[model samples]
Target: MFLTLVLVVGVILVWFLVIGGVCSWVWSRLIACSSSWASPYECGFIASSPKFDSFSFTYLSLLVFFVVFDLEISLLLNLPERVVGFSSFYYYFLFLVVLSLGFLSEFFWGYVRWGY
Candidate 1:
């Protein structure tokens, strides 16, 4: 047991030493100092700054609808081969009811509009 433990520790130590040595050598030889460069790259053109727009209500609603339907589909796909109980029917009915409610709510709230 002692021999095995020493062997494992020695192997791990050597592994770490090799990895650290390689990483340090690569860093020293290949990496350029950011201060020596004008930009992130050698290009002269300044790239446009990234646009950071907040998600609109329509986009948020669509995202929520996608997630809800995706979850429902995944659950349905894993259903038992033979559903033989009132519980499954009850759950499925409830799910459909919830989906219908969501659809109606989105329609009434103008989240389903595509005339933008």
Candidate 2:
């Protein structure tokens, strides 16, 4: 028990020391570097024009939707085996059915047309 306690204390002390040192180093570096880092063209790169065209909202919305659904599918895939029984299989089947229906609707609406 004493050995375990000493080991835990030692680990905690080491972790805090390392984290504090890193934080101090990063803070000092940021403070010292900010004065010379504000200009956009500081690294020998010259800006030719003021600005270019902006991104479309449709593309951003589609990207967000893709990310949300991708993360949901990943989480569903990693569910515990004990919790994923026959009901989970049925749930997955229902999800796939809904997804397919949405895809078909989008296809019909020309939202998923091939090529730009």
Candidate 3:
């Protein structure tokens, strides 16, 4: 329990520090601007808009697919390192077949079909 808490806190702290540092560095250039200064300098043009636009469920589903597939591919890549044999190749091929079939099923169901 304590270890998880520490890890979570550490991650949040580092995330905040990195974001704050980058924002501070970016906005620091605006301090020397020659006009009414608030926004980041863009060679004399200041532009602003909503921080986040409208969200889409389709886009969200696509993002989830990307993450899940990426994680699976990463794990698949490690299979060769842990199990070195001809059977490992068979397992890898099987995994790929299953993954492809899963994606096709999702496509047929329109869970990740484009423009759906």
Candidate 4:
């Protein structure tokens, strides 16, 4: 118990130190700079007006689709180790079903559009 407590305290201390250092660095960079710091040259773009006219739903849809597909790939890759004690045939069947569902959803949603 003592060892575990020491380890946990060590971890907490390390994380606290890291966060404190980062906060100090950011504070110094943002506060102790000249007038040029407020300008757009420091990775900050100044605009006279709003940049976006209207939000496009397609971008959000594409982002959601990407996240879904990425998560599916991660889950699929980790399945073998997770289901090692289960029947292999069941695993393959479930994989096929998931893949088919993804393909059908993409096709039905017009996500597979072809253009020049």
Best-performing candidate as measured by lDDT: 1
**12: Cα error in model 4, Å:** 11
Report the lDDT tens digits of candidate 2 across residue range 21-99: 9999998887876855656588665567456477775687588669858966885776665464686777777877887
Instruction: Flag the better candidate by TM-score, 2 or 3.
Output: 2
The reply for model 4, stretches above 4 Å from the true place, is: 1-31, 40-49, 82-92, 95-99, 108-116
Q: How do the residues 1-116 of candidate 3 rate in per-residue lDDT, one tens digit apiece? A: 99999999999999999999999998887675745455555445446643546678877887888897897889787885874578678877887888889989988887765654
**What is model 4's C-alpha RMSD?**
5.6
Rank all candidate structures by their TM-score, best first, as comma-separated numbers.
1, 4, 2, 3
Residue lDDT tens for model 4, 1-116 = 99999999999999999999999999888886677667665765565645776667667767777887786687668666774666665765687698779878877888755451
Where's the lowest-lDDT run of ten residues in candidate 1?
A: 38-47
Instruction: Extract clashing residue pairs from model 1.
Output: none
Stretches > 4 Å off in candidate 2: 1-46, 49-54, 79-84
Clashing pairs in 4: none
TM-score per prediction, in order, is 0.57, 0.48, 0.46, 0.49
Candidate 4 residue 15 Cα shift, in angstroms, is: 13
Residue pair clashes in candidate 3: none
Those runs of model 3 whose alpha carbons end farther than 4 Å from true positions after fitting are 1-37, 40-54, 79-83
For candidate 1, the TM-score is: 0.57
Task: Give the candidates in order of lDDT, highest first.
Answer: 1, 3, 2, 4
Answer with 1 or 3, whichever has the higher TM-score. Answer: 1
Where in model 1 is the C-alpha error above 4 Å?
Answer: 1-46, 82-84
Show the lowest summed lDDT stretch of 10 residues, model 3: 42-51
Candidate 2 residue-pair clash tally: 0
